[model samples]
Target: MTNDAVLHTEGLTRRFGGLVANNNIAIQIHRGQLHAVLGPNGAGKSTMINLLSGDLRPSTGHIFFDGQDISGFSADRRSRMGIGRSYQKTNIFPTFTVFENCRLAAQSREPHPARIFSNALSYRTVCEAAERAIELAGLAHRAQRHANTLSHGEQRQLEVAMVLATSPNVLLLDEPLAGMGAEESARMVELLQRITPDHGILLVEHDMDAVFAVAKVVTVMVNGEVLESGSPEQIRGSAQVQVAYLGAEDEHHG
Candidate 1:
């Protein structure tokens, strides 16, 4: 495990009865880099993210966060410990203004449960965090707009803002570009490029173009095991990756 890694998994394995979800895998996500995990269906990408976020415990192996062993921690605990995640589905309060949703997420990180019921606008610290997060996600102009009123792409950015509100050191983003069009995808790619310079990002995405554009390293998985890992150029040219994941598209064009 690398000492500089904010999130590291060692020999991580998980099983359900007789079925293995994640095999013996060791991966590192260093600070200030975006590491992307790409694989076909049933390749254990979701399982790996679940394990890292502490949603599911590893049947075998260990998870570390910020140099601390946190395999035993729960999902909420991991979030508080600077490990945050965004789901494929939009996760924001539909009725609330964009700022309000981000404010709530930021308030949750303060360790004061009573504040949950308090008027959110009263907290200066939380407001500042929300502003910073919204700005980071490129939604600062829409902060006052109701979440439901925004387009799907803006909603997705709001979800990312919510994750940022928690001030996490590592971000696990699952298919953030899942439903985006070309323009939205381009915006998201830009947002990722800006944020990854300071935080470690573990992205699970099917958009090979965006992944190749923003990721510093790419890890390819096949049937719950790592098949190859290297720079974008290397992954783009790997025969194994082309067969297992990228298919014949690259070969046809190359």
Candidate 2:
């Protein structure tokens, strides 16, 4: 177990009857670094996230988070234990203000989340976490606006803000740049850059440009197995990655 790594997995495997979604996967994520996972559809990217987030239990493997073995933990337990994630589909309270949404997320991690009778602001810790998350996610200026009023990009940022409010050490972001314009993509990338110093960001994205721009390490998967994992430059020049993934795209375009 490396003290520096916030998250690590050994032989992380998940099987569904005859199908093996994730196979003997070993990976490590250290804080202050962004790790990107790239793969085509059916390459087990989603399974990896599910396993790490405790949304799906591994069939055969071990998961360690911050030096604790948490493979048996549940999704909510993992969230409370500082594993945060944003889904591919937008998940926000459309009618709520940005601050309210963040405050709700912050409250979820609190020991007194069920204290409904008390004033929400009285939970100073939750309030502070929410405010800090809003600032970090670049939604401070829009804190008072309803969530549905924000653009698609800002909504994406809000998703991250909500996760940050939980005070998570690991962030599993799935396709954050899925539906965004050039400016929005740039802003999200910048936000990721600013936040990398705090958490071990596990990004599963199809956007190669974004992956290369922000990722310190890259892992490529094929057919539910890792074909290669290395620095961004090495991944870019790898013949295996080219043939299994990038080259396929290039040839299709050609």
Candidate 3:
């Protein structure tokens, strides 16, 4: 693993009974870069994400965060250590305003034990973090809107903002563009581009066009193993990658 990598895996593997979900996978996520994982269904993309996020312990191998071994850490522990994750499904408070939703996410980091009954607005640090996250996610204009009232794309943006509110340096995003129209996808693409300068992002996405557009590095997995790992151009040019995955996408688009 590179010494400078914010997050890197060393021979990461996960097994369930006789089935191996992920196998001897080693990947790196560097600061200020977008590393995307691509593959067909059941290729272990989600399993890898879960393992990195600490939702599932690796059956073998190690996960390093900022050069420290974090293979034994729990999901919440990892989050507090500057690793934030966004799920495929929208996880937000529909009844809360965008700011309120973000604020709640921020509050998770510093739940004032001394002021358990205090008004949430009284927490300056939490509020500021929430505001910063909303801005970073490009949802400042919608800060006052109710979450349920936002469009599908905006909801996705809100989910990202919620993760940002935790003030993480590394982000694990799972299928962030799963449901969206062309315009909404474009907006999300722009948002991702804007944020890539600061955080190390590990994205699991099926939208090949969007993945190729923003990712600085791409890792293709097949049958729970890495088929290729390289730049977008290299991935596009790889006959192995085309045969395993991109060929099917090309056929669908062609």
In angstroms, give how far residue 66 of model 1 lies from its true place: 2.2
Measured on C-alpha atoms, candidate 2 has an lDDT of: 0.90
Q: After superposition on all CA atoms, how large is the RMSD of candidate 3?
A: 1.8
Q: Give the per-residue lDDT of model 3 (tens digit) for 1-254.
A: 35789999999999989899999999999999999999999999989999999999999999999999999999999999999999888889999999999999999899876876788798899999999989877789999999999998888888888998998899999998887768767877897888899999999999988999999999999999999999999999999999999998889889
Of 1 and 3, which scores higher on lDDT?
A: 3
lDDT ranking, high to low: 3, 2, 1
Find the candidate with the highest lDDT and give its number.
3
lDDT of 3 at 39: 95
Q: Estimate, for each residue in 1-254, the C-alpha lDDT of model 1 and write its tens digit.
A: 34778889889999988988899989999999999999887889988998999889999999888788999999998998889998778877999999999999998877476656777578899999999999978888999999999999888888888999998889999888887778878988998898898899999998988999999999999889999999999998898988877875566578
Report lDDT (CA) for all predictions: 0.89, 0.90, 0.92
- Best prediction by TM-score: 3
Q: Taking the tens digit of each residue's C-alpha lDDT, what string does model 2 give over 145-179?
A: 99999998889888878988988889999888888
Question: Which pairs clash in model 2?
Answer: none
Model 1 error, position 144 (Å): 3.3
Model 2: how far residue 83 lies from native, Å: 1.0
State every prediction's TM-score relative to the real structure.
0.91, 0.92, 0.92
